[model samples]
Target chain A: MPSVKFIEHNGTEHVVDGTNGDSLMMIATSNLVPGIDADCGGECSCATCHVLVDASWVDKLAPATETEESMLDLNPDRESNSRLSCQIPMSDELDGIVINLPEFQY
Target chain B: MTNIVIIGGGQAAGQAVASLRQEGFEGKIDLIGEEPSLPYQRPPLSKAYLSGALEASKLLVRPEKFYQDRDVATHLGSPVKHISPQERTVTVGETEFSYDKLLIATGGRPRKLTLPGSDLSGIHYLRTLQDVDNIRAHMATAKNLCIVGGGYIGLEVASVAVTLGVTVNVLEMESRILQRVTTPFMSDFYHQLHTERGVHIHTETTCQGFRGQSGKVSHVLCGNQEIEADLVIVGIGIIPNIELAETAGLACDNGILVDDHCKTSDDNIFAAGDCTNHPNALLNRRLRLESVPNAMDQARTAATNMLGGDKTYATVPWFWSDQYDLKLQMLGFSQDADAAVLRGDPGTRQFAQFYLSEGKIIAVDAVNSPKEFMVAKQLHGVAVSPEDLANLDVDLKSLVPST
Candidate 1:
């Protein structure tokens, strides 16, 4: 199990145990971490699960699909490391990955 | 603190409440839903929830604690009887609630076929969770399921029923399945897919009525042909719930007419979700959409403008459907597209059909190709030749300029 840290826009942090094969959005949302509203249920169609990954771990994670990048493009607070958390599947290698929730997804 | 009343406890209303709180609005929020449950996600009602793959608790759009902690007054099972814009009050049963600003997110209701033998016990329409719960209970003993529409709901139910080892038959009034929404090529693909899965599809078939055994639906009567069925699911379409807005003297044309800000004829009254027909600057027309994304986006826009922010709703509409391991994602509208450029081979079950008009991309329907659909969504109004779009060798990502 990998431990992922999710930091909200208000600077609130939530550390949750990420099981292999589960999405980051799924882990945060199932664990009651605020700000990760996966309204589309891990579907890449909606950008509600957007997260700004820390630059240190950006290269370590899998590259975002064109669909994920398109959703991230819609985010008002999108950064270079912005990614839809649903596209990021959890794995042991991603243990200690830090992500920041945007102020708003729209 | 100003009082805001939002009608219909569905996606739009839920998003409105969250958007208001996120905007730091400390006001009274009264969420009135006709259903017994709190604001829940209806998309999964036909998929996971219908098949029992997902638990009832997972259907909740937000945790129950969020509403309580936010002080949202949720009136479940309480249907608003009337709305008086002059009095600025909404009447739910015997109670009347006053509001400084009101949002009409009443959404829409499933349209039913009005013909002989329409009233039967086993005939169902997919809308609320209670409706699906009823259908699921009947599915336990149901062996043959007759779907009266080839739309999303009807096809989704067919998918679930076939998976349950139930014989499925889809009756579509149109020439082909999904004719109203998708191109012929896309429709043919689905038609073949469903046929290969042991599901029978009847196209250009109009069901006149239903016959029942002991008041339970037993067979469907089409124009001279009778199709045997133990259960029937109707998914023809939905009619917008604009009675409240119409009664209030607000402009009503197909739906509650709202401005770009989502405000109705009455300044203090607004509407969102599938209930409101508003102008889409992006599509260059007025449209009413029934997708979850459309509801959420318009709700946030309505919330912002209600809070003194001068914002307009102009996002490209997108929709999706899941069936038998295939996800069909679409963006924009293909109403007037002159040509459809096929990307990738449909034989692999992973391809995209881009609708283009005079060389400018207008819309795309991607089957199990989320990446192509996402890229096409970003290039909504961009002019791209069909030649480049057809070539899979051309990286679609490079076509979109970095912001």
Candidate 2:
């Protein structure tokens, strides 16, 4: 199982085991994390799963696809490092990646 | 002077902006949105947009010039990064914007399947212009399509697919289609209608995964069964965008928590649309709704409050879904109704299901009958006896005020 570290908006940290093919949004939502609504169930249509990638590892994450990019346009908070967690698939390489939650998703 | 900022470019946000302006508020108005285009309506995305009955240009809630003409500073493609309640500011990228009032109208997204091959090409979720564009291109050549989930989106898309001479198979995890929302009568009516149209429907079946060929979906795996398809659409449900609210120290339960006034924990900030959980006065409890009626009503309330007006959004919630020739419209909330009054024959396809709770009309589910729905909406608070509701000869309009 791939493990990912999540640092919530309140600075609470928790490590959760994620499957290789699951999305970061799914892992966070299933773990009952305070953030990461993953509304739309990992579909890039909704930007509720918006997360700010750890600036240091932003390059390691894949670039936003056209769908994700278009959806991000509707997100409340748009950042250069902002990525829809639903579009970010979990993997061993992203184990230690950190994401910051936005102040409003809907 | 109050500085009002709205974060969204959809119908709800548009309504809020318009309401605020109409209320004669002489304040700073900032409309920050991620969409490059102006605010638009989403209900048509699954229907008219797919059938070419409506153009993309007509979907916009207002013309581009309207924003400038109305003095609404529109920020296209700019996402709000963070909100500092203490500082009364919101950050978008490197720029920090100040606001005395904030409205969060971020909407929901379409739910996707977790099965394998979901990442393959030709899989679609209809929520925006680009999504419609991609699906429209494939729909031109698509012969067979598999729809996972039997909700409104799936059914609406299936209706369009069948009309285009495409074979559609709808797979539902529940025992009946639309099990979560509609009554069994409505569900059976729809199931029969779809089945009669030669649609292949599999109920109580879970999608195991998907099989792909050449990076495109070819088959859907359901337990030990396999169904062939050229396109796949998953419409399980939507999740409210609550991360931003939760992160900002706002109360969230299924959605951003809001009172009747659409106010969040931070009085300076408010929320509406599919991303909010508001107190439904009719239900006497907090509930999250996905209907356009709820969104627009909440928007109005939020706008009034933003303009320093004392108004509460306590309107009865309503929703509608168009499938094939049937238009299902609902009024109020019915999740806890103890009795239901049938106005007409369900088998005939024109009737209204009036849900009653403790001898009062709580909610109504009408199919192909808007007059009854309108009457139900008007008589929402008036106590009507079920015996009178069951009588067909009695004029329902008489039960409530005219107009």
Candidate of highest DockQ: 1
Docking class of 2: incorrect
| Model 2 Cα lDDT, one tens digit per residue, B1-403 | 6688888877788878867876788788989887787887777788878888878875666556567767889988997788778898878899888998889998877776666778889888877777888899999999889999999889999998898899999999999999998878778888998998878889999988888888998998998999998898888889887776777788889899988889998989999899998887766888877777677678878988877788888777777777787767787767778888989887777788998887778789887765567567657766787877878787665575432
- The per-residue C-alpha lDDT of model 2 at residue A30 equals 47
What value does the lDDT take at residue B74 in candidate 1?
Answer: 95
lDDT, model 2: 0.79
lDDT of each: 0.86, 0.79
Interface RMSD of each: 4.8, 18.1
Q: Model 1, stretches more than 4 Å misplaced?
A: A1-41, A55-83, A87-97, A102-106
Off by over 4 Å in 2: A1-106, B401-403
State TM-scores per candidate.
0.90, 0.77
Q: Candidate 2, residues A28-77: lDDT per residue as tens digits?
A: 75454556644333434335578888799799988887556654643435
Error of 1 at B153 (Å): 1.4
